[model samples]
Target: MTHVMACIDNSQSSLAVCDYAAWASQRLNAPLTLLHVLDEEKYPAAADLSGNIGLGSREHLLEELATLDAQRARLALEQGQHMLEKARERTVISGAAFPELKQRHGHLVESLSDLQEDIRLLVIGRVGEDNSRNAHSLGSQIEAVVRTIHRPILITATSYKKPEKVMLAFDGSSTAYKTIQMFAASSLCKDLPIHLVTVGADSVSNHEALGKAQSMLLSAGFLVQAEIRQGEVESALHDYQTEHGIDLLVMGAYGHSRIRQFLVGSTTTTMLRTATMPVLLLR
Candidate 1:
């Protein structure tokens, strides 16, 4: 069965990520998997010992360093195990029935790609444990992971708030249209208030597109609101979300349409750094 896979890490957002994943799993009625990856580069087994040690003490020093490396590797393994267990506990507590837990040692992007086919949605923190220090920076693994996989990703904010309403940042692109259609057919957006927002000049073309989308959802018995606003996409959308109590954002990843293009731009990075709610990115 397809699972809502949560990428659990030692970030400040870890608990919130797990909770969001659990909520999503229950809401969608899908199974859950919590994965923790130990990147070798981040937690190296040994420091480089070449040319630094004096020739006389080299043999003894090398053996000592080897022993230390062994210890470090063991500690890292234990730490990762603990992280996964904690994530599983939190997920189950949040209402996931028997979420699967996994610990992997490798590049995170590669591991995600290997399991991409089995994942229906990917949940991750906007900023990871180490990268959380830089508030404005996106998680180091996010770009690479999104670039590698085509699955929808739910990027959690640092704080967990159960979402009551969802906003779709719509732009006139095949990808955005497809995303709207996909959500319209799924239970993920059903029975909840939806805000379909398009930011830019108010043109006939924009109106036609938004109108069709609103009409489609209304026909499907969705409580949908379609709004058009002017100015920059991020700022306008952010203000609207803040004013309207939007708790979840749904949008495409990248496209000629402005929303996804802006998503790949600096604005989305800024949003990730200071996002107040979860964002569901359609790839």
Candidate 2:
């Protein structure tokens, strides 16, 4: 079975993401592993600093430091447990099995890498409360994990409610086919109607690709429809989703090159900016 790892914090965005993860978990019949990492390196105990301590007070200061570290660790664990419990309650209500909560006292990047052995999908909130609004395209931790891991990542924003009307942006790429196969096999799309849109290099090419994708999805038991549009990928996709009231937008990330993603930018960047719904980005 596929295992989806949900990295959650106590932020408002995380709560909605947890609900969304639960929704996905039930549909995929996948095991949900709820993870929370305690970033003690960033938020260390203030009392542990020993710059002004004299020789006589060294022992007392060291003892106090130990006590403070213990307290901080305890509080972090307690907070993590509470958040996981709340997430579990939402998962049960969403008709999904409760996830196994995991709390690790370390950095998020390290924690995620350590548990990447059996994880199929990594789910995380778009941004946390501590994150700066100026930051673009996910937080530091999210970016680090995505860049490091090869697994598919579903980054959900706070505004995500539920994915009812879904849109698939197909480009006749291998990644696109992998994404489609995943959606077709998952329980998430069983009841969800999909709009298969293929952006055309030319009118004829676009029509052919869109028709092919529609036939494939129809054969897979999806209530699929096709739309062929001529324009820039980001603009065409954004406009189509907006007009159709799409709730979820699924597409392959970084089709051409990693260098292009950074230097020339990509359609994924443009779509992320213009999309009004949650994006399921496949590698």
Candidate 3:
């Protein structure tokens, strides 16, 4: 069965990721899996000791290094197991049913991609272990996973709160419409109030687009408050979220040409960095 998978690490956001995953699992009535990956790039099994060793002692030093690397790999495996167990316990306490624990040795994106077929939704921390100290820095793996995985991803904050209100950042693009359709079809946030916001000029076409999107949600039995805000996209959405106390933000990820997104960056990335609440990103 497809499960809600959460990437767990020893970062500050790990707990929040678990909590949010539990919440999503319950809402969708899906199984949960806590995945801990020992990234080869971060935890390699071999190290270069050639520079430090002299000609005569090179073989001995290499043997010692091999032993040390094996020991380090074992330690990393043990730590990952412990983290998965802890995350599973926390999810159970948060009211989710028994969750599965998985540990893999590889790059995070590769591991996730390999298991993408079985993933209904993916939840991960906004910042990873390396970037957890800096609030403004985005996790290194976030964009790579976003670009590679076609599944929906929930990038969580450093903390989790039961979501009270949901805001959909709509831009009248095809991606935005698809986001609305996907959200309406799922049970993830069905009963919460929806704020359908468009950050652009209040032209007739924009109003029509907003109205159309709002109608789609209303037809799906959602309580939607549609509005068109003026100003930059990120700033306008942030202001509305703050004003309305939105607990979760939903939007399409990378809704521009590949070159354009690369050249100018993506609003999705900006929102992930700046938003205090959890963000559900749809491709």
lDDT (0 to 1) per candidate: 0.83, 0.71, 0.87
| Ranked candidates, highest lDDT first | 3, 1, 2
Model 2, TM vs. native: 0.81
Error of 1 at 178 (Å): 1.0
lDDT of 3 by residue, 51-150 (tens): 7666577687688877888789889989999999999999999999999999999899999999999999999999998887986778987888888888
RMSD of 2: 4.0
Give residue 258's error in model 3 in angstroms.
14
Q: Candidate 2, which ten residues in sequence have the lowest lDDT sum? A: 257-266
Of 2 and 3, the candidate ranking higher by lDDT? 3
lDDT of 2 at 210: 65
Residue 69, candidate 3: Cα error in Å is: 1.0
Task: Name the candidate, 1 or 3, with the larger TM-score value.
Answer: 3
TM-scores for all candidates: the values are: 0.92, 0.81, 0.93
Over the stretch 199-230, how does candidate 2's per-residue lDDT look in tens digits? 76657755766677787788889999887777
TM-score of 3: 0.93
Candidate 1 C-alpha error for residue 18, in Å: 0.7
Runs of candidate 3 exceeding 4 Å displacement: 46-57, 256-268
- True-structure RMSD for candidate 1: 2.3
Candidate with the greatest TM-score versus the true structure: 3
